[model samples]
Target: MIYHGIRLKAKAGVTQEQIEETLESMRNQGRAIPAVKSFVVGRDFGGDFDCGAVFVIEDLDGYGEYLTHPAHAHTDRVGMPLVEKFDSYDITDDDDPQMGAKIADLHRRRYQSDPELAALVSKQP
Candidate 1:
């Protein structure tokens, strides 16, 4: 299993509704890709990014398929331009129950701890 995690910031002036819609689109896009075990997207509030998504796939082959998926490109086309910038982290999905929690904790910690990076992703100036 593999974990593909992501965070996104809406372009300055993009509406909140638009951001949420884009996230949902991405979740749907992830679902359409072959071998995607589970996928989700959501808005992160009072935090670094405006939105985020996560995808779990079987392996590198599946991950590759997801990357080339038309739905992914289409969602990217719709969502990317609407965001100032974004960040991502990928890790080998560990079978240990604690590993997933650890990875998720690290993701949140990075967001909560990094301001400059967040600003950069938000396209400040």
Candidate 2:
């Protein structure tokens, strides 16, 4: 399984209501995506970030599906603007040495296909 995790810090002056809305959107994505075997979305305690989320997928194909899901895009569009800082990482049990490169390629292709999404990511501050 691949456990994809994200940590984020909200921008200064971002209201609690807005943060909740984004968190709810993330919760919805976790529930709505078929590729997500399990998920968690909550505040980050011992980290520099303010919040974090993790999604577990069975395989690389499932990870791709989770990333491309409409709900996932919705969360990004609605949540990214409120983000001050963001980081993501993946932990997988797969033994393939190329797995890391393959995952990075998935993100690269995604950004290439959707410039708007890339722009939103670039806007994070």
Residue 113 in candidate 2, Cα distance off native in Å? 0.9
lDDT (CA) for every model shown?
0.70, 0.92
**CA lDDT of 40 in candidate 1?**
77
Model 1 Cα lDDT, one tens digit per residue, 1-125: 88787788777799877877787778787768877899878876666787788898776567666665778656666776777767777778456767656555654554366554445435532
lDDT computed for candidate 1: 0.70
Residue-wise C-alpha lDDT for candidate 2, range 68-97, written one tens digit per residue: 899999999998999999999999999999
Candidate 2 ranges beyond 4 A from true positions: none
Each prediction's TM-score against the native? Answer: 0.69, 0.97
Q: Model 2 residue 8 lDDT? A: 87
Q: Give the best candidate by TM-score.
A: 2
Backbone clashes counted, model 2 = 0
